[model samples]
Target: MRPCPSPLRPLLLGVAFAAISPTALLAQQTAPIVLDEITLQAATATGTIAAPAQPYAGGQVSTRTRLGALGDVDVQSAPFRAAAYTEELIRNQQARTLADVTRNDPSVRQDAPAFSERDSFFIRGFSVPNLDTLYDGLPYIANPRRSALEGIGRVDLLMGPTALANGGVGRVGGTINMIPKRAEDQDLTRVTTGIASDSQLWTHVDLGRRFGPRKEWGVRGNLSWRGGDTALDNNNAEVGVAALGLDYRGDALRATLDLNASKQDLDAPTSLFNAAAPGVPIPDAPDGDINTANPFEFHDSTHRMIAGRVEYDLAPATTVYGAFGASRYREDFLTSNYTITAPNGDAINELGFNPQEIEGRTAEIGLRTEATTGPVRHRITLSAAYALNRNNRGEFNPRLLGFPVAGTNIYDPVYLPAAPDLSGLPRADGLIPFADLRSRSVALSDTMSLDDDRVQLTFGGRWQEIRTRGFNTRPGIPDFPVGEQNYLYEDSAFTPAIAASWRIRDGLTVYGNYVEALTEGPMAPSVAENAGELFPAVVNRQREVGLKYDLGTVTLGASLFEIRQPNGITDPASNVFSLSGQQRNRGLELSAAGAPMEGLRILGGVTLMDAELRRTQDGAFDGNDVPGVPRTAASLYAEYDLPSVQGLTLNGRVMHGGSTWYDQANTQKVSGWTRLDLGARYAVEAQGREIELRANVENVLDESYWASSARGFLAAGAPRTYAVSASMKF
Candidate 1:
């Protein structure tokens, strides 16, 4: 076995916690506070608002502890599979980007080379464009961004079988929701600046204020900017984002509104596969300053989102909440001077392509109510969603030659223009430069629970319908060829779920859930006479069993899961294959996070899966492991506050993934590799103000590996790099 790369200042924090005692840590917090007893009277319920007779665990961070479910509820509690990424974890790791938070999730996999476009992610073996981007529980889809994390308070990842709670039409993989920062009491603010090993620099500011009786009305805002070069030659990315929000809370109701916007630019370098030569590195480019004119390129995009939520109480045990959100995204990409190598590794550039633009929008609204009666609890929700997506692309498909139009000489480069229709091909009159689509969905779910203070049983059902329409034709070229289709005649589906949990103790619980979910994909363009031939809907069914263990100071969780789909999409339609078959994914996952001891926190997880295509027309992939998904993956991250030095902490993490095939044929493969990161932070408080200094080293050992590879391109992971940052808070 390869030696574990030791992080700076060694020792995982968990290892140190076992050596300490709770009393030693409890001493850090003030002695348990005791309150004086006094005569108390029942507060009268106000007009039209529901009031609780007692307090609820609304502040519990564990509710949103998974990936994306947004603090709304636990995956086991929701009508569908969901995960929440809490704020504590994000702050501790100094996560600067959306992709950073997912590195440790067993259900979410970031493709390859952390920052690549295709480097996005996959859930349950299906490629997702960054886990169903959402804003305040609404779809927040966008091409890609650099500082997307800065605009979010937390992220909720909802996995497969979500056709109900999240609306109808969506990817088979899952969805993601962005929980924006809300107003808080106290004049709190934080500013942090840092530089990475790749010479990148970043700065961020978060501020919140409260000024009113009840402190019920307040404002919060954030600003972030980062720029720098990475280990990859000619590869660099930068971004800026700003967000503001307002909140109002009253005796019977609470409301909030938020607006956020951001922009990102990237200069992507070509990612080479295999050795540049017999002994050269995979990213064969020379170590020097590179320019756009080189055999590489990149572009930019803009994102904007707006959302609001309102909660009202109707009775002592009932409360109703409503949420609405919307977002817009724009993208432009270009490629020139790329190198197309032959199967023999000989240089060739017989191809070139460019994306003039790609843009889309998403909007959603939902209403939900929570009620309780004695030992029973119930929450019902209704929602509507719509999305508009369009892409105008251009590619040069030269026969016998690949892209980069492979120049005979390695020292020479070629430039290409945006010619999508191959300067006019046969049969298909006019260039098919674009495809447009509009999708709308409506859904509802109801969750009913019964508990005897120790055991809880939950039942829920979701009903949904998806309708989509397609169009084609560019602005100037109104006569352009465009394929149109619809799901108007498709059937609406109802998926039901049941779950039971037994609490053995305060910190441990065992849960078993059986759920069924469904989804519909965007219709692909029709190239044949039958316009509806390629527009069929896809659906899935999944069941899972899991255990939850919270040790107060540390939490441990494990789950055994099985998922299957009766029908899916099969690519390369020319092969005459049908998708009316079954696919399955069975896996075991373990995750833990919390303060193991005073000033020490550790987060780690691992997943082992057996995913496969059980049946298909081709029958070739029946028993083979699903391509592009790892069989086993693991991650470990920890941070320790120093004992001798006040306000200082050390952090480190290592992530590993097993290898898998790249295609259905299983003939080609991408090897597995591990990456390491190390960092530290020092804080000082003085005269009503605070300052922090931080730094991190990424790819500490500079291991070379392919981040991702597909039919047309490959991306490499960054090599060794260092960054430093500083921030102040008031």
Candidate 2:
């Protein structure tokens, strides 16, 4: 798994024949005619020309975005079930995170296992923590455990429950926004290099600029690095990233600023799924890139962020906006915790050390307006938001230091013995003072607009608030009671939303939505029986209907959904875990992205869910079936383009999922899997710059299954890997 050298193939074929020669296409058409006569003498000395960040059609897949605040609208008028993935599908799928751009999202999955240093998901079936991602639309500033897509540009994905558009503290199975990367008006520099599949090694840099005299000042920058070995076995990893962005545009003022930093280190990482001893039967899944972690395990993380935004325009249809963001996160983990004593995979392992630190802040303010009364046509918006989070955790235990760490057998593997000197433990920076979280929201929306605009309705509401506190950094054990007793908890809710769309004509549309989501509840764990109870805060309801079509070059969509929530286990004959469970999920979805002809292109989707679990605890998990819900899922991706090799292009992708259930009484299941991927790209143009080359192979058939599950762990699929990249632009 470490090959591919040979002097980099004659330096990539001498830069692909000096980038399609022809004098580099006549010096790129005379350098844009000497930069358009110095941009027409600076546009006649600044009359104006700053409009540039809205032109993405160079490869389809973009139906407008800003999903979740209903801002940039149009995905057939946005009535929910969003999708957005562009950056040309994350650079034609050479994706480098956000789980590789959600692996072409089919309602997303992957709850663990994928170079795990943190990055979890389950989108339409709950659980999406990575600290609840969002950025640009601001909310704690992205960093859901190692997220780096080299300065991202679009990744919308809004499937359900956003509590009236991002505020009531997300995740009733959706919400993920990351849009950054500005500074365009076209002066850029790009560089990229890559490899991965047991050897790693990648590099990237991108820069952009625009200045004064009407280009309205802007700048962008990104840098990246990745290092060594990783398709498992003895694992190893390293990463670093940096970003900077700034913007300004006048005529009514607009501004932006962003900064970021990242770092990650891993060695023998990947280990999680140790809880199968109640009757053992969950083993089978120990191959694919094996490494039950612990070659002196390690995992580290660091991140920093800053964000800002401002907008103003007090007339021609009024507007005002403000946003702020902040973030700091740190992590350190020592792995190995595998407990599946036999089912052919025998396991016992133990080695612990957890460390964490997090701080976040977010803010938002808004006003938007447009009006008309007698003939409809409104469009109002009012907003407010606040979020704060703090967390610090610590743990250390090598069997409490008597040097006890032994147990292994995930299909025969052992290599322990190098970690017995805790240095007298107590690290994680002398941790103490565990949780604190707060979220506040206020929202109002309107969107009327009738007949002339072909009906569009939208009404929103949000008045959320949630506060939480928890402490007791392990003090004298006994259900750990130190300071904060019943772990203070607070709650509030009011989420409401309604939506409707009906273009019913030019390119078709028909949408409907009803939303609600408000989560954060489920405490009481000291072995149940109401141990430190503090519940109340769980509302998740959604209903949707959709259809969209834009046949002028392909685009289609479909939807029908339902969701219900309420969960809080632990009863065992009155042992009290409260909230008395309940779960429901219903669905049907289908989607497609376009470029139906010349040079082909197509994005894909399919989902079919049904999930259940109606009431538990005394009914013993009632109708079962909701543990890692997966009643079918699908995805496809395609690309073509090659009229006799003019800069090549070819691609493929397919992914599927179906059987899933690993507890909650549904007798344990895990089958249903499929995966395939392939890729290629070329593109050229030399001395004038612009070059590209990409390659991909992801699980092309390595197939070792058991790829999804969450809560009841179990994650394995991911093996046949390979990637290549090359980029240039100046």
Candidate 3:
């Protein structure tokens, strides 16, 4: 691990002072504040505006979520598989990003290097891009690579395609949505300070207040900063974040506005490695905390976003809502790529730099109405969504003997000399337009309730249109009109979904659903025989059946699902890319959450999947397991409050995955691994202020292993690391 720096002392001291000052100020006030009463009354109220659901008994997970157009629904009533992690869970675990919050989910696997600029995940045997994530029902605000959590209130994960719910242009795996924090009716002031392994230090402040008569106006703000050496040798990271939210509530109208800005810088970021040579045996993973990239290799990113929403009740049974959001993101990075050349950890490395910028806007409008027709109650919704994204990018690459850099051994790392000078090489000083995309969709849905709301049925459909154009941004290439570029792909599809749920008893529900999804097709690469050929959009079909039981304090769910989609592949002999194959994934999932006993809480599940490649180019790889998918995976997390010590809790988690193949032929493989994490938290009253301290250790066994194989590459699991934090509220 890297050594701590001298600057960390002042940051820690400042955090401590910030936390204590609030307490002193509160004491000086002439009127004593009754916090418990204010908090309880605010929590019990239900308003027209949407808010995150309360945490379960243990405060680790939530029972309700706003999933797509379904609005806020309890897990037991929704006819699908999903999970919502609450803000309380994030704070207790000190989670920094989405990856940290979803670590205990059995159906998801992260597919990126720990310190890399990008974060990717595979869900239910399919890849889910960060761009697909939504923020408050609008897409394009959450950064796919590294999204800050300071402004987020809840993280919700929905399994399966979201075409009917979120519209087209999504993956079959699922969708992730982040709900921004909103100010409550009560006043709050909190401060937190934390340190991680290898001397990383961080501090954050959160404040919320409601003003005006009847507390109709609310405001909340958060600010945070972290800088120091990371767990990896010679690697360091710095991050800064600021967020603000404002809202208004009235008898007929509700409105909210949110703004955020963040920046991240990493020195010596981890590099990605390709699969080993076909003939050579796969090499063992290197030390988990080793840094192989040169010190100069770094990544820097900045992002800004703003979003607002408003809802008005036209009548007691009718409502209208609208939302608009926009974001701008920029990234500059220089990194090395490594490829194993021999079984003994020999590899070749290359250096390159890329600078890119993206701007996007998204909007939504909807109307909902409810009525009762004699014995049947009906709820109907009509909505439309629109989004636009534009990207600009530039790169610099200097080749040496056909390779970007010299070769080195992975086991015994050796840093390369200074990068070759690129002054003579042609450089693109300014970014050029790379791609532009526009998406529009309209949806209609209805839910019918019968037998005093004991039986419910829902059906929906969406008409989606996607238009995309690409450009040749190469510096020396002859420039052409933006719309006249060689690549232009446009398509439209109408997808449908139907679901039904029956109440078997007071606490158990049985449900099933059939849904379809559509994804943009791939364009053949220039090297392919049918280069530039644009294929038709790919369609995915899914069917699922599940059972959910809510026993007051414990929730249990089980699901079985199957998803099938067309697979595109390149023929070796013809050098042509086409949709010549099919892929299918069938799986079963079991999950449980909430407190089973008075003091013991559990949140986790197991997933068993069978993913296969079928109808390949020549049937050569038919019946083979899909690359990067594990057959069996399980995760378990438990927390217990000690009866001997008030306000003291102990928690632990375990995760395991089965072996996975790296190639379609199944020749290269990575063994499965298990990891353990443990932590403890204690709360107490200090000087009339509530203070809490927490400490956690991940990878407690210090085992080094390969975490996953996705996109034909391997990622190393995180090493043993410690985190300690202290927070005070007034």
The global C-alpha lDDT for each of the candidates, from Candidate 1 onward, is 0.55, 0.73, 0.77
Q: Candidates' TM-scores?
A: 0.77, 0.33, 0.91
lDDT of 2 by residue, 1-730 (tens): 2232234334433443443344543464112112222221111101111232342233545666674444566666677768777776797788888878886878888678886687778877777776787887776668858588888877778888786767566678887888887878878877677778877877777788989998888988887766778888888787778889888988777788899988787887876664453345666676678887766778777788999877776754556777888988877667766666677777777776657678899887877665656667667778788888777666432334454557778767776767756565555555655667788888888878689767888898888878877775554557766545447668887878888888889988888888886777756644343444456667788899988887877778898998899865443335455666778888888988777788888888888988888867568778887876788899888888889989898999899988787767766566778889888988887666777778889878888777786655677877888888777787
The candidate scoring highest on lDDT is 3
Instruction: Please give the lDDT score at residue 612 for candidate 2.
Output: 86
lDDT of candidate 2 at residue 385, scale 0 to 100:
83
Worst 10 residues of 1 by lDDT: 47-56
Question: Which portions of model 3 show Cα errors greater than 4 Å?
Answer: 1-13, 16-48, 395-403, 420-429, 475-484, 522-536, 568-580
RMSD for all candidates, in order, please: 10.4, 23.9, 6.6
lDDT of 3 at 148: 78
Model 1 Cα lDDT, one tens digit per residue, 461-503? 5565544333433233235333323223344567766766767
**lDDT-based ranking:** 3, 2, 1
Q: lDDT score of model 1?
A: 0.55
Number of the candidate with higher lDDT, 1 or 2: 2
**lDDT tens digits, residues 1-730, model 3?**
2332335446645875565454543442123223442211111112226555778667777878766655677777888888889888889989988888877689998887787776778888887767778887678777747787888888889999887777455678888888888877668888888889887878888899988887889899988887788888778988888889999887678899999988888888886676444545667788878877888777777888999988887765567888889998888776777777787888877776657788888888887766666566667778898888777665322232243567887777788666544344432235666677778999998877789778999999888888877765443435554334656778888889898899889989999999987776665643355644566667789999999998989989999999998876454335566776887999999999999999899999999999999998689889999878999999999999999999999999999989987767778777888889999999888567778889999989987777777655678777889898888887
Which of the two, 1 or 3, has more TM-score? 3
